[model samples]
Target: MAEMILTRELFRHMCEEQEKLDTHIYRTRETKAPSLKSLDIAYTNEANEAIKELQKDWKWWTLKERNRERFIKEVADCFHFVASMANQTRTVGYCYAAIDHEYQKVSRISRECYPHEDIFYKAVKGTVQESIASLIAISEALGATTDEIMTAFEDSLKKNYGRMATGY
Candidate 1:
């Protein structure tokens, strides 16, 4: 519970980078409208994928080992959708514009949020910030250090670029 090392500045930069991936995603593949609701559902689905990765160890009867790397990758994917969600709002402005007041709220909620401690199917009344909090909760639950999460994000971006190259 120490202060999160992932500062808002870094978070914004990460979002910008994710925007590149999202651009490729739209160009190389069909995508839902860049609407908040669409992004919210997409982000929630990615969160569930992260949970699926975490559940690899849930079945005591199985000998499967949870892959930290894959779980972190899924968490990173959550951010990808988050950044897209941000773009739909002029207030958040994908963290490009000054959101000092808004970010204060987002930071607090993101840090304190564990509203859904179980499998998250959908957000009842989700916003971009709430979705971000959920993503943070998943990262914390999986014990993924901020550094690891950032690295996974970078890797995901690279993979997205590769996917674009191959028409994925």
Candidate 2:
């Protein structure tokens, strides 16, 4: 397998594009009010829904037997909301920077000993692993290749850029 190369510039561009699409879509539908605040609420709601889908408690029996598609879609919705939020704050770069920092920490730890002495380091390491697990789950559910996700992300960027400022 080849190494994946993701850059902040690409991520920022993608988020900007997604934001444009979000604005246009909301305006066209007029079903819900749209704003950065609304996007934040939507992001939280989607995250809650994703968590519910992953639940293995009593509620699990009530969910669809095969929820892979729904899970994938819900995750995608979360991403859309995140993109909009990041674009509004002009903080997509910060988000990518944090991801890269965490990635390096994980790589370093894998090559060395775990930081048993540092609670913060251990917590960061665990967070990195958990984040990877979530990504793996999404990829598995969607049956998506890395290339496919990349292509879809790029396509989204293009479509978003072509959309009207209001998401029409």
Candidate 3:
């Protein structure tokens, strides 16, 4: 058999392993019956399990600090949930493009605040709702119209999110 290239598929496989680890962690901690069997529900269950494990460990900081594997697994769980959710919703293809569009908007704002790295990072890390507000702020600062920025954002997303099946 041909060797599989180390690409998104590899990352996804890692994500799957992390998800299983998350499930084990959850089962060890919780006794509640799982209520959902849909892919979406499964994703939520796994994500919640990771969160619960992290929270439990967090109450004992020393335990979390000592368990590096657990820390890494938690991060992987978050990414796995996101990627799985995006795939299920058929939104994964557009993510890279959407992110790039967001980056440009962030970059423009960063340029205006040159030398203020904190401001730049804050702009880049804003929530989706906050991003809309940030764009408005950027427009006011750059004297461009909000409509233009939004149009660009929408166009980039549409171009990037074109449907493409990413079979794991």
Candidate 4:
């Protein structure tokens, strides 16, 4: 008699286990919001908080575990909000596209314009604001409320953080 291998079934089982782990991790950190509006508020606030922290020099210090943890948590929080909002808004893909537009503008300006600090800041800020507004409109078009759109934005940020952390 020959021994039989079940490699395909084994791979499926492993994938299922990994999914469960992902769900467990998500559930452990997620906070419940009764309405989509609340989720959006949470997303915007959390993103703001993360930006503040990122601006701090202490945030970049490797010795500060608390700061690192806080950064990670804030990003994760933003992610949750975004996911909820995207699902509600149906504008997830469009929002990402808008972000790309802003990034491209920034890059173009960075290369064409001389290294002027104030001008760079103005350009980047203006572009980001425009992108956000356009994304908001897109989200609304998808039948999403303001809150949902904000949440989706946060979720996009979180996904980006994950990629950075993993060096992907």
Candidate 5:
């Protein structure tokens, strides 16, 4: 049998876990509101927080430095929000389109705007999938890896489940 990069079953498991965590986190005393705007805002905030972790090492003079572990965990937080953004299970293809989007965003060139465009893809993906792929791109750019993300995400999910049990 050929080796699989990421199977649909694994993606489905992640989605199910995130849905449970989102349910607990989004519930309120009065009501629950999961508008796209809200999720988008949350994603941005998390991404910003992740950057702040890197900012420490970005400073030239200050002795403060980036904590690699914490930084990746912060990035993982962004992944958590992306996973919660209206859970769609229609996509599990390679991230060619998604990777291209990330590349163009940083490279300033895209097939959409130009015929002879730079591109590469191992799989197809959707909107949310693209967002996830972009995060992977960002992570790799910052010297992180998918393994770290997987560990951090699982840790976060476990922590959230603990919060759920605590009536939080």
Candidate 6:
């Protein structure tokens, strides 16, 4: 299959849609406030959830059976929150650029490396945090293809657009 590409326009729209969904849901709940917490807290929590999904104490052979779908969903959730955080901070462009750049680096490494080698760890380059590097690595280790991630993002954007304006 041809590689899936996420353009800046799509990223912006996804973030906008997610924000709208958040607003609508919060408004409909009546008691829940609309203001999102600090991005640091949100990102950390989402990343932790993704990590937990991957860290299920199953045998290596059973890992796919036990955690694949949940892990993918958690990764998607991370993307959603990350996009929202970027939008809130007016840094969506930077966020997209960074992700795209890192993704290209990973792709190049994957193309050049042996399958059994630790491509993820090897893909890490200057200035990238250990945690972020791990995330990029784990994403590949889990077989989360770029196309799959892009599809999840697009689906999320559509879902968010379907929500009521006040989140109801």
The most accurate candidate by TM-score is 1
* Stretch of 10 with least lDDT, candidate 5: 115-124
Which portions of model 3 miss their true places by more than 4 Å? Answer: 1-37, 56-66, 96-168
Shift in Å, residue 101, candidate 5: 3.4
- Quantify all predictions' global Cα lDDT against the true fold: 0.60, 0.50, 0.38, 0.41, 0.52, 0.55
Tens-digit per-residue lDDT, 101-150, candidate 5 = 44445332221322111211210122444444444544555555446667
Candidate 1 matches the true fold with a TM-score of 0.66
Any idea what lDDT model 5 has? 0.52
TM-score of 4: 0.37
Pairwise lDDT winner, candidates 1 and 2: 1
Clash pairs for candidate 2: 23-166, 24-166, 24-167, 24-168, 25-167
lDDT of 4: 0.41
Q: List the residue pairs that clash in candidate 1.
A: none
For this target, which candidate reaches the highest lDDT against the unseen true structure?
1
At residue 59, candidate 2 shows an lDDT of 43
lDDT of 6 by residue, 27-57 (tens): 7666453234655455556556655564433
Report RMSD (Å) for each prediction in the order shown: 5.3, 8.0, 16.5, 16.0, 7.9, 6.0
Model 1 per-residue lDDT at 63: 67
Please identify model 5 stretches exceeding 4 Å from their true place: 1-12, 24-33, 57-61, 86-100, 103-135
TM-score of every candidate: 0.66, 0.50, 0.29, 0.37, 0.62, 0.57
Where model 4 places Cα greater than 4 Å from the true spot, the runs are 1-34, 57-69, 106-168
What lDDT is obtained when candidate 1 is compared to the true structure? 0.60
In model 5, residue pairs whose N, Cα or C atoms come closer than 3 Å (at least 3 residues apart or on different chains), thus clashing, are: 94-123, 94-124, 95-123
Model 2 per-residue lDDT at 68: 49
Pairwise TM-score winner, candidates 2 and 4? 2
Q: Write the per-residue lDDT of candidate 4 for residues 1-168, one digit (tens) a residue.
A: 111121223223323433343354456546332367675566567655543433433234444333433443454444455445544455556544554454444433333542333232332244333323322322222244434433433464456457545755
Candidate numbers sorted by TM-score from highest down: 1, 5, 6, 2, 4, 3
